[model samples]
Target: MLINPTIEQHDEKRRDKMSQVSLTKGYWFFFEHEGNDISMFGSVWNGKENVSFNNEIVSSFRNLNKFKSEHSFSKNGHNYKVCTHMTNMLRGTLVVSLYCDDELLQTETLSQIGKDKPSKRFFSKTFLWFLVFGFAVGMLAGYFNLFG
Candidate 1:
């Protein structure tokens, strides 16, 4: 007797939860291509990227401080490429694209904007300090007649 396994379908809500995690630990991307399970992991902190086909890692590499990185691999005479890009720095948005045989198959984006509150407050506070410091410096310069 043989048992058949069912494939699990991913929804948009799961993707949203994954995006929030991407900014901290790393990113996990899952896709299905021609009945093949394709998964990828990328770490922004360590600059490591890995691509897996059917639970087997096909390509792995490290690229640091890059706005965009691309990894390519071939399996069973077919070529595959995974491209990761930092679309927005402020929002910490990461866009991952998968291609097979030079054709785009799927694209996913991970973003941590309003989801992370501490970092958001930090930016606002920093900007306020910058404005206050600039105003103080300008007043000091005027009082000393430094413009002349």
Candidate 2:
């Protein structure tokens, strides 16, 4: 899936960094079937360790040439065939465009935030504290002034 750059950039960075240490280097494996046979073997290169096929998003990029010769899928009406499992794998195409305030999430999730600073961080810690206290006291005074 194409992740939102503003949100998923960190994840992408992590994946790219960890992919370099493949002891054997990131390489491709090929296989073929009857009309369109296919095979793919690679560990999911997340930020951490190389995850297994179950976790990786295998696609044509893993090996495009071998891919076109293996798997077969019907498109429009034609039964176009592919040679590798990667050929049939789902691909993630990230399309980043300008988003307006209306397009953003209404809820506040931790992933959407940068650092864990509170809402009041922009203001001085001491002044903000006094403002809160003053607001509380003023409310109480107004209540007593009205009821009493």
Candidate 3:
């Protein structure tokens, strides 16, 4: 099975930091069945390095073949909804939706990676070069205005 999962940050402050660092803030796991991705819904960090999965989800995956339903779980004040739908009798897909308080944060589609993949790093080399060029241009403009 091929699994592709995406994450969306909710908090403004944390989002800003993630944009600058591109580091994984939490851990996630999913099960693949016949090339279909079945993502677990209720795993969260307990302020430690290890992630904690809800007991219900664990049991459901144990009997995954018989599991055909939707589940909801809450962690760190965030609510999540997860479900799987069969495209055919033999293959299906899973969807995980996340919300903060009452506002929708992000919805991840777990599937195979695409050709236009995003850079893992937050800041690219080209972005750094652009920053340097902008700084140089600003300094030159200020000098011309003040001393020319």
Candidate 4:
């Protein structure tokens, strides 16, 4: 779904304010085209926003994986590229770089505040095992009732 530019701008500003207030680590990369700031992950970047583009570009954007390490696209007579580099996996250090027409536009290094907790993974595995055990016991009970 396409998002309105005004609403997108508002959300970006709000997120910026919240991050500043809480000192959280977050980053945004955007490009300016025709007096509008289009966020990289927003509707415009995904070719959802209305523009005079043929089907091929739109399809390319639609099929593109935003999480990939590198991407390059051209829209509205401008070339854009996004590159994500993993500096440290354990520390969650990421370097996001943006380039316009072969010129570097912006680069940001972002890191998570704390280490990831494994409790959620552990809980999910345990729950799956519990369900399997319960199902096995239920099947055994049904067999005994039918054959005994």
**Per-prediction backbone clash count:** 0, 11, 3, 0
Worst lDDT 10-window in candidate 3: 43-52
Candidate 1, superposed: residue stretches over 4 Å from native: 1-20, 114-148
- How much is 99 displaced in model 3, in angstroms? 3.4
lDDT per residue (tens digit) for residues 55-125 in model 4: 12221233224333556767768877766665664444556666778988777565443334354553565
After superposing candidate 3, which stretches have Cα over 4 Å from the reference? Answer: 1-68, 88-92, 111-148
* lDDT head-to-head 1 vs 2, winner: 1
Best by TM-score: 1
Q: Which portions of model 4 miss their true places by more than 4 Å?
A: 1-34, 41-68, 114-148
Per-residue lDDT tens digits of candidate 3, residues 41-129? Answer: 32111212111232222223222343234455564455544443322321222234433345554454432122333443323543676
For 19-74, candidate 2 gives per-residue lDDT tens digits of: 12121233223222232222223322321111112222223333333322222334
Write the number of the candidate with greater TM-score, choosing between 1 and 3.
Answer: 1
Please give the RMSD to the true structure for each candidate, in Å: 11.5, 21.0, 17.6, 9.8
Model 2, CA-based lDDT:
0.29
Rank order (by TM-score, best first): 1, 4, 3, 2
Q: What lDDT score belongs to each candidate, Candidate 1 first?
A: 0.72, 0.29, 0.36, 0.46
C-alpha lDDT of residue 66 in model 1: 82
